[model samples]
Target: MIEVLVVVGPGLVADAGLLEEIAAREFAAAGVSGTLVRARDAAHVLSLLSPSSPEGVGCAVVLPGRSAEVRSLIGRDLGAVVWVDVERADGVTAAAGATHLHGRGIGGLAWGIRHAVHRVRHPSRRIAYGPLPEQWGELYLPGADELYLSDADGPPVVMLIHGGYWRSIWAADIMGPLCADLAGRGLAVWNLEYRRPDLHGWDATTADVAAGLAALATAHGSDALPSGADGAAAPDLTRVAVVGHSAGAQLALRAVADAVAGEAAAADGAQAAEEDARAAAGEAPAVDGVRVAVSLAGVLDLVEGDRRWVGTGAVGAALGGRAPEGQAAPPYGDASPLLRLPLRARQLVVQGAADDLDLVDFGRRYARAAERAGDEVTYLEMPGDHFDVINPATPIWQATAQAITQALAAGPTSRG
Candidate 1:
């Protein structure tokens, strides 16, 4: 049977007969027999699913500002244009928001009217790296609030880690307009806000992102960065970079593989017998440095993203439950950042191509296992889904800010 589907937003187009009553109760609850049609957007539902338009038995397209043309027909359509954000939750979750299947499209509608017109035209600057309250984060840009905003110390430090699958029902202000479009490009945006793996599982969201990245590397080793409006010079945390999406790109690729396995355990001396028993049963803190990272359509193989329509299982609801059956070690080996491997850091792995079916082959299986354990992987492959690389009105957010300036001008090459 031929399949063609497209479902955009504004509450699925103010109700076009509830998209043929949800494709006739999903083919009568799978007894299998399809027929549902409606197209006034997504380019009139891709000229009726191309290959010479006229196929039947599988088409459900609802329209309405098709959120800036569903990323050029999501991965050449086989299915995966499910966006329905209508501005994030409140009262019926913002009138039914979070149907979330943007497979790679989570930002559009003029990137949410350019981050609510830059939060009422520039308003941010709360900083605290740690000392809890989710170890504080926000710093977004565009003259943060004016006092000498951008003459230097900005561009470099992306950080950002928003993806709801880890639940607490999604936060980090859904990457506040991609952190105000990377702090209006002078780039120095943190946007963290942790703790939601159901209160205290996965060690309270990996120790609040390792105490807000060890209070942002002890305030970038005491240069105390954080300023924008009128007087800049704040970001550039020694050239840091991390960008995450879906499940915060599996916690920024397992905290950049535990900070490149804690700098190979302090240059191969002691640590690592499971990091001295997860630091004598505590979990994540010394927050080492991350070279570069990004994951977007993430979920990098957490045992095939723990079931129930991906992210609905959200990797066993963020590793706090599922384990028993013949359990021969199923606890997501080091919490599945592609089973921890080759992490000198320099990964990209953007991915999209209509992102569901559990993150459309997770950036080609984590760039073929971080390029077979040598790590300096790139693997871009764009075209929207999984919230279109955090939707800055997609072009996959300028190909993910030019792959984070080519992972900050590439350094450590890997592929032993």
Candidate 2:
């Protein structure tokens, strides 16, 4: 008779009972005769898998949960037994499957398994940026904290925006390792920290990002020179690019639009108030003048916020209830990149084929909108979920880095 072993990671001894139940159910359903064996820890599991064991156990099912230490132990001994992982989050099982498990019927299961694998592989990075010794007016900068690899400095600065439905609890620190990997490639990285809902409301968070960008630029002396090509006398500001994931992507686009609008309003206000000229002008306002924008698994359409894909209250919070609707959308269009696509920025959007949040359709919509508006937009559909793009070891991460490198190498233009 074939035998199966269930190895529970340390601290999850209680899950052994549940693993037994699952194994029994799955094995009976699949017409496989197997007995479940529980291991106290990863080492115990490895010891049991040795050739010295009773010779009948066919495969080992390792339920390490999120413990990377345990997973590493099992991976080293994978050749000895057919390794399987049972992922658990918050004491609830997330997925169970073999290491090489694949099939159309198990796509969702596979995605969950991949997400767990990614967590084990990449891990998080930690970093801190200040509530500076000098405050910016009454704001009392809260000193942003994030996870990023140290020593990220290249010709171009790439900013990675993490998506936590725009909530503060999910900071950019989650993407720290990925930032570090990019930094390892000699890319200057600004893993930003901004006010989120827990700290401040949506509008405040939005303004905080603008302030943060300004502060970052000031700190790096990016504003000292006029706009010009990369490697020119232009202070290397030309190659700056923003890579935003999920809600962060929406925010990046809005930042660009807001920057343009602020400039247009200020420049025009200073001129003679030519009502007819202003009314007849067809040019769109630009914000922050972002040269290139990339969105990974982004929620781009705010009008569809109430839809099951985008989620409602969160989008409302992000826009401060000021998002435009119907014909009104065009007037306040600067708040969304979809509405602001007329601005000629080089844009790239990547979405996961199995994204559980916002779905890949959201990224597709934004890409189509940008392309229709005459912007150069590249949309890459990778195989993974919403969080997979930030996985340091994944091919999606490499593709993102390459895209940024290519965009930065293209130099800068005043238009986007």
Candidate 3:
């Protein structure tokens, strides 16, 4: 029901024949039954992209030059703009300030087209958790009429945090398919988008995650979400789950630990210590309604990750500094989930058998450490690579989703 403009830049910048071929393949795979228009140049493309353009074109797949006019065409409301660069030119399209896929060569173009089609079919309501541009999340809910009229308290909410080693080039669009899949299964999904440490610093990234979680928990009764064809509703916080991938897994666990600590600090002195002790003994801590937390091919142990120089020292960059020489200190103590053991929520740690060996080690060791700290944990090690866990079509994700569904169905675990 959407029109896609595959703009082939004049010159050797793009392969016109390959562009058309990929577009055809992707459109067919997406089951869009939509129209694809090939434009010879940028001007030709722009003319066809108008609101009154023929056949109602709503999105573009562009292979562009480094010109200002080309970059300015990004981030428009015209569905989605996906910029393609086969030579892996770093961060160019991302710096254009748009929701796009770039730098993966031909694969990027194919995924971008699929992403564009997905957006048109499953529209999400954008809700801002803070005033900043990066402080927002896309909420996807079951759009059925019965869902709106049902008196029952809505579906369980799932908060998804994406990962690209905390870099700006990788945005929440990476989680698009997973979000749509979960929403289709009748779960309200909040796909969180936050400031990356590379551009906004580590503190900002962590703070944004915390604020986004808080906003998700409180959105139900407030005027924070706007209603329309998207039908954005406050998420069902009574049963909430946080699902984070890669570096985002660390963020998810850290947020839960922070929430547990805050709740303990606010209680009566002796009672708070008693509750903390109980929580550390595998009992549910007195915190908000977050029941389960899942980590997919996660970077769980910052201390070890830093020591091993994981992600080419991305751990240190995310924390804003390298780990101290002798004893791991400061940021690692506060930010690392391994250091903050016995999080109040039940934990689900999933890792690909063939992923970075370091991540497999992290997942295994962290699950054991969490168990020793009296936290309930379910660890699933499957056959696949790093990206397989995020791809909705993969068996790994199917198993992960099954685990999550079973956990949610079990309801809140009774305190031991």
Alpha-carbon lDDT, every model: 0.60, 0.54, 0.75
For model 3, the run of ten residues with the poorest summed lDDT: 89-98
Instruction: Mark the 10 consecutive residues where model 1 has the least summed lDDT.
Output: 90-99
Top model number, TM-score: 3
lDDT of 3 by residue, 1-416 (tens): 66776665545366667767888888788766455555556576677667687756676666655555655666445445666655444444343233555556666778777767677778887787777767789988775452422335666778899998887666788889998888776677889998888878887888788878878655667666433224544455777789999999998888878766666565546666765764564333333777788999999989889889999999998888988876668788888888888886699999999999999999999999989988989999999999999988899999998888677666784333
After superposition of all CA atoms, the RMSD between model 3 and the true structure is 5.5
Each candidate's number of clashing pairs is 28, 12, 0
- lDDT per residue as tens, model 2, 249-366: 8777666555555556566683344334433542122224356877877877766653353554677665556455465453235555666766566788888888854557667877
Give per-residue lDDT, candidate 2, residue 211.
56
TM-score of each: 0.31, 0.56, 0.85
Scored by lDDT, the top model is 3
